[model samples]
Target: MGQLMGFLNIEKKNQKERDPRKRIGDWNEYREAMPEKEVREQAARCMDCGTPYCQIGTVLNKGTSGCPIHNLIPEWNDLVYRGLWREAYDRLAKTNNFPEFTSKACPAPCEGSCTAGFVSDPVSIKSIERSIIDRAFAEGWVVPKPPLRRTDKKIAVIGSGPAGMACADQLNKIGHNVTVFERSDRAGGLLMYGIPSMKIEKDVVDRRVHLLEAEGVVFKTGVDIGKDITEEEIRKDFDAVVLCTGAGKHRDVSIEGRDLEGISPAMEYLTASNRHLLYGEPLKPDFDAKGKRVIVIGGGDTGEDCVATAIRQGCKSVVQFGKHGRLPENRSESNPWPENPHVFSVDYAYEEAEELFGTDPREYYVETKKFTGDASGHVRSLLTGSFKSEAEEEKKWDADLVLIAIGFQGAEDRLFEDFGIEKDPSGRVIQADDRSYQTSSEGVFAAGDARRGATLIVWAIEEGRKAAAAVDLYLDRKLSLLQN
Candidate 1:
């Protein structure tokens, strides 16, 4: 702790966000920079706790907390505190392959469990991470450094989402030739498509992709293993195969008017915006919420993103429904210090809606029953419900566009059938031990979302690293096959 008493002494500071009124006119990112000096001062606030629970990254006792990747939080915190910006960046890159993504997108379970946060505000760990990584990139510190040795072995990874990218990057780092296959036109999967530029800029993703390409990872776009190329082809050519296909199959309300026009899943809506950025494609006509009274059902991160997107698109009004009750502002008696806190949070989308709509747009304790469409079958309104429990129900609301943000089922099943891979009953995830990350099929392994279902980007990176190690071992044991 360079400053020793810095947690108690310095006031907490975060980056400045864009002016709500002006930012809604376009899709640029909302956050502004904290001055470099101020960022260092904030970094000085980490307590460097002897036992940092922040890195534990999970919830326990219905309230477990800790970093899943077990990031070297304290080391980087000290490095930043000492004004070792480049050194801090190096320390960060040692564990996280893409701090820029997680710094912007993660929910920050690390902060919830921060030791200083028990009584005072937690150190802005995410902000510090972003600063270090951004500085590194500007300084040419981020470059292509290929592995020292080539295995003469190759791997095929399906899905260009975080999990697949993580697997491919790690495998390439360890001297294995890696080819990433993506069903979409571009390679980044969701980050390249599902997330809008307002949340994560497209150039940032492209820069990393460019770096990975320079580092010997091969990317093949517009290629679906089950369709364009057969699973048998992949099995025969590659030394090993890894599945990172995401759980992108949407979960719909499946009500009476679901098939009607103007009722859509959140991914469809967001993907349209991303595709436009990537290729300048015409917008997905079905999803424009402009000048309409929009209702988003489901109050998770996706719903918040929708509220923000709608506001930017000039929606007349927008409201989101939360089936769960509002969380408390602070931890309850049961939730003590150094734990992952799950109190209430107001994200960018909610704040943007508040600026335009004159109130928080979330309607808690509400549910949607069905869609009410006009005779021509475009959605005229939503058949709604208000429920405190399973037995209670109330219905109807006037809405022009209804976006269902209810989350996902699992990975698209075609990859499993194509690869003849096995999955657990929940449709989540193929079962694999933490160390090996292997699938039931021989010479095929799974990682990230395909192995663990939906999860954080940081976890996906860690899993990729572990799988790289496992693949290394798998290759060493089968050198005869590699000679072919």
Candidate 2:
């Protein structure tokens, strides 16, 4: 460790965020970068524990306890504290292919597992990570290095999302000819459309895509694998095929008046708003939340994103509904140190909503009974029941626009069926072996949400990299850098 007792001397300092009142008026990132000196001081707080659980990457109580990609958190922190900026960037890029995305989007479960967090605040791992990558880009250190020789192998990736992109990047670096097929007009599947622009600017995604292109990854946008091209064609054209299509089949709540005109899925609404912001496309009236009372169902990350999007669209009012009780202000007894801390913290969306409205927009312990619409077949109100059966209390709330932000169930079955791949009970693709990511069908492999179900973006990248290694071993009977 650069500073042996730095944890005792230095206090944790976090990056500041823009004022909610001012930030909600624009669609850019709300957080400001911390000064280099202060960030170094924050990095110096790392204790460099004997057993660093921050990079253990284990699952506990049905939730992730650390970074799934197993980032070298302590290494980068020590490097930053020692004023080795280039070394910090190189260490960060060792395991994670997209620190920019994870730095901005990941919830930082690594902090919860930090040894320092047992007493005081955890090291500002996410902030330091963002700073390293941003500085690397500014210093012209992030450049493309295309492979010197091309192998005879041709690999076709089905989706252009995080998993697909990561897999393609790894394979391309190893001299494989990789072609990514994206169904949407753009290459980034969820990163470009499902997420709101305020969280991640579209240009950041574009910049990475351009870099991938320069590295010899061929991207075919506006091409649906199952529809535009048949499974036989994919099998005949490429030596091997990897499926990285995300779990996009959203779970729906069926109830009375579900056929109302104003009700829409959260992805549809978010995609419309993103298209409008990026490509000058017109926002449909029903999808637009402007001048309407918006109610988001399902309270998680997706629901929080809906709240943020509705607030940006100039909604009159916004409320989010969750059926379970909210977490306590601090970690519970069951959630011990090194486990993921389950506590209530106001995220960006809630902060923005609280600033715009008088109170927090979250309503817990509520169950939806049915939707109530007006004479014009448009949703006007929501009928909900208390979660407590003893109370049996029913309530109603006025809503002009209703967004179903419930999480995705699994991947679509059509694509798997088209490729003759077997599926598990939950509709996830069944792998042939625990170690190898190959599917039941020969020459076909599955990764990311398609195999493990919906998960964090960090896991998706890890799965992609691992699957790429498995593909290499299957083809050449050897392993490469990705395997290690």
Per-model tally of clashing residue pairs: 13, 0
lDDT of 1 by residue, 335-391 (tens): 677667768878788888888878999888887777778899888887666678666
- lDDT for 90 in candidate 2 is 96
Off by over 4 Å in 2: 432-434, 478-484
Least accurate 10 contiguous residues by lDDT in model 2: 475-484
Q: Each model's TM-score, in the order given?
A: 0.96, 0.97
TM-score of 2: 0.97
lDDT of 1 at 425: 65
The prediction achieving the highest TM-score against the true structure is 2
The local distance difference test score of each candidate is 0.81, 0.90
Find the 10 residues in a row with the least total lDDT in model 1. 57-66
